[model samples]
Target: MIVVLSAVLLFGANIAQAEEPLYVSVGQTTGNLYGLYTTSNEMWAVATQRCKDLGWKNLVFIKSADVTSEVYDLMYEAVGTAYYWSPIIGMNDLDNEGRWLWNDGTPVSGYTNWGPSQPDNHRKEDCAALEWPFNTWNDIDCGREQPFICFQEPSEYKRSQIDDRLFSIRKFDVEKGTQEMARSGCKKDGFRLAVVDSDAVIAKIEKSINWNSKVGYWVDGTHNCLNADNCEGSTSYVCEDVFPLVLSNSREDYTVGNTIEIECAGSGVSTVNVKWQRQDGVPTDNIWNEPLQKIEPGKATLIIKSATLEDSAKYKCSAANDIFSPSRGYVTSINITVHPEAIKDAMSP
Candidate 1:
């Protein structure tokens, strides 16, 4: 009887565990391994140590928009189409107020995808995270608990080859100038209008300008220099590139007996094989055998009709082609929780 009780306990524990894949290999290109932990949420400090305990270097450091886009896509694939507070990043302004810095001691500036008037420092929020759907940066309270993403980098790992752009600031004799005048002024000093490209340049520009003067400067770019455009009427303008620097940057519920559908799509390649899985904590046995219907050439849908409480588990969708393996595929997921009571009430109505 005692042996039988042990066996039953083991089986029950397995049933309680999440059945979806939580970690996907990003491959060796970045010289890093990435993992997303969603089984439980943790605060900022606890989560930081959690990554270290798991042999990760730190929380995923977002050094560029490309990195942001890639991680965002990964989150979308792994968590499905519901709103998530998301994987806590390694950015904070703990030492200095308004002086945000990455965990690696890099200042936060330039090419920021901040939600409208974000990082307002609401309630002394020092930590930073990427909000879902919009994929914008937000300052979060470090004490808040949330799922986190971790990256493991080797000791010999180096920064990416794409360098950050830098610039020198030139304050005009008279504050507030026209676009052409700003350009001419910069050209006079053997420089063109300041092309604000990276965070380093933005820091320099902010430091050189007089915030109290309320003067405008001419900057060459829009959307924080993601594209080329001339911004007029600024106190000071920036010169050409001086050097290279580096910098970085929710859920839905379901009722029981309802049909659940999730769409998985892949781009950048012409064709892809999409697969769905339930996180089982094992390398194998997670491959979901549910038949997927190809909604489009590179897209597929996972549908479960008349869902039950047994379907309440994290589900992941992966898309891959010949160029990429399932481990390095475009993946997304949706955590579904079915409510038996809600379903029953709806059925009664």
Candidate 2:
């Protein structure tokens, strides 16, 4: 009887074996790794929490318009064997009434995959799902359970995408801030203040700024100087043969009070001149700079604060004298975007 019971127990254990999880690599260059989950058709809310518990940042959501095709294929492969209720994205009208927000804290702009007049918010349906047809987004009830797509670190792919566009030679305007401040801000977000040496680039930059109705960007060019034309005889200098100073405008992200820093990417930190400037083409009276906070040689940190909407803008870090000769300075910048959730708390005095 004991031998027979042991055999039955072993057989039951085999029957309960779990299926192997499937893995997919996204963003050919960005290399975003994801795991497809199909253990059960758990509630959208429950699956979201489970994905986080399973060691992922959040659901496999779309960040850019160009990613729709890649995401569609991944979802099709994931649901091949099981016809479960797994959603590929984490989006809902949970916080506000009509607007759907992404789990990654970004706007869901550009590409969409709504199933023909769907997302009617039927029965107060808030959660998004990729149902039987696959490749389409459906606004379903959050209580409904489904398998989901969970992804690893997303900032890597986001950063890589921005890095690839760095040399595009367009007028990469930031929201606001002076040249030095913009330079520092851009480095934090994986971009540099653009270096425009051609009239075509200047025209493109000017058009973008005017169309957006925002202040102009501080490029690596003398103010008032446009395309071999003394033009306005700008006071700014542009050195051609100066040792290039690398500035890091990483990922352009921060909470209130976060220390925003920009450092020299290479040599000449000891004698380099670094300053923070804003977008209005002015260096004085900016909000981030402290009158008494002794500026260091290699890097400068600004404690971001402010409750108003106008607080978000571009900042540039200008390195001159040593590498920037006779006023010719190569500059870089980053845009400082404010977090909607953190804004109120950050602005609290």
Candidate 3:
């Protein structure tokens, strides 16, 4: 009883049993409850499993920015001035040093709060923890035992799958996440990661989804920046190994001198560029390609203007990106024909 009193004084609040939701507040979801429980000298691995079996006690690996702030406060109240685990959840460069990732193998979204001179990789330390004196991150060895926190994951923001050219991980749980989970998430929806390359495509994606500004959106720019770094200046999140698929068809017919249009199906919701070529290998130059999209029902439109007899040919449209190599580019064959004016008039009746 005396020892418990001292610990509560140290924490500035009475320490409760780990199973109790002492600080339950409105979280991203209904069932989520945040708590920092003392393990009385349990190692990371032991604590992880014990917590899971006890309940939904996955080690709290926070990713949401807004949630992080609220959690910092909750953590302060829970631990007062003590170090606790953060799960600094992300991919670790097992092949290389100084690289990290989210649990799903997607790069950590954005805004990492590494403690000063932290991630020093000291003694091969890989996992992260919120160090005391301030809940900044530090890459620490995973074997050490200490009281750890199990907090709620990122909030489930609404996502929209647009035009099979771009995809976002919808309803992802921080617990038991993998890159395949994020990638295959798009796969299940018949899409892939929306690769960011140009300002136009970037702009289109921004317009397509109502991404929570409070949280960082995962936009990989390995080729868009094309400077070796996934990002322009400091590399943040890099693209994953997800390739888009074709979900729609691109075949159309029209009268001579009339506008003919065809839309290449997207591998999934993502961004893509389509180039048209004649059956005889002549690139069609009279076509205007632009992204016509909306969130209600995500779609990208491609248009061929003022079809003429010369436009009668089998055209090919392929979507390509560097995320997946060997250029197994998704191909769409469009057969465009200008109905003879006589035939058009005859068919009009």
Candidate 4:
């Protein structure tokens, strides 16, 4: 019953086929693949389905200024030097007019580049597009056929469920192996040993397993009942996977006497928690001591009012979600140097 329920909730129904669309690789950033669907021009719904047919969860969702730049470049090159209308992507306001949301149902906030007088939602225009040449976003009718961009992050192992799948579960058995093998085995199959975050997942497993058996199972779970073990030997393990956490637009060099700002954006399964800390300095783990820090759904920004000689140190940004293991959080760092002398050498214009 759970399998049947999950199947219905997780995967999409098969749709009619269309001419193969050309997928041009835009570029890989932080292990994620991005590309444009050049050939076929389809309606908003069709474009969404086209990407799903190819196992890409959605059309590209721009989260930060850096990602926005990358998307603009991809579109510009895809359509040659000429100006085009726009690329049909996942952004839309269909659910609630005037409130644009990504395909994943997250609201658009923090960063946006809309054309002048754009997203006027003209004539019931519900879908969103990235306009070429202008390099801005515009609202368009959902029925208008336009080419779109697709995004994907290939998993390292065999997958029973893709990124689009919701609350799906699977298990694997090693018969006789160490916890490392169990984890590695899951990875080889494109999964991580299950970290039971909910009762629903474990309940499903209980019904299927011989609870009285002598064989031990491995799970990075939270329940006290699942006592921590040496993990030296386990015969069975549960496997689960999500979009791997990736960081972008990080690691820039800065000088002293100038105000400094660094941002770290993240992409992964769900709500990604981002943090910044000094990696090589007196206030190492105490990031709260920083002047200002801003946080959004999947991004974080660290600001320094003015750089000083003492501020010349390495600062690190870390991002993780509920799904990530302790060691698997995405991390990036920046190095700052307080060069007041360089600032003093500046000539007045």
Order the candidates by TM-score, highest first: 1, 4, 2, 3
User: Candidate 3, which segments miss by more than 4 Å at Cα?
Assistant: 1-32, 81-96, 153-349
Candidate 3 local accuracy as lDDT?
0.44
Candidate 3 lDDT over 208-295, as tens digits, reads 3444443333444433332233322221221222333342554465788886655444333243344443434311322223222221
Total backbone collisions, model 2 = 54
Q: Which candidate has the highest TM-score of all?
A: 1
Compared with the true structure, what per-residue lDDT tens digits does model 2 show for residues 113-184? 677787799899877876543456788888876677766555634323211212211222333334565455
lDDT of 4 by residue, 1-349 (tens): 1121122111122111233333232223434445576567889999898787855668888777757655643543345335455788778998889999999999999898888898897899999888765667889999999878776544521123322222223334444566567667666644556666566545544543335355446666573123234334545555554543344444344456677877676653335577676633221223123436788777778777877787777665655444421112334456666666565555223
lDDT (tens digit, per residue) of candidate 1 on 141-200: 999998888765544232221111223445666746666776677566434565655564
Q: Which ten residues in a row have the lowest lDDT in candidate 2?
A: 1-10
Measured against the true structure, the TM-scores of the candidates, in listed sequence, are 0.42, 0.37, 0.34, 0.41
- Judging by TM-score, tell me the better candidate of 1 and 4: 1
lDDT (0 to 1) per candidate: 0.55, 0.47, 0.44, 0.57
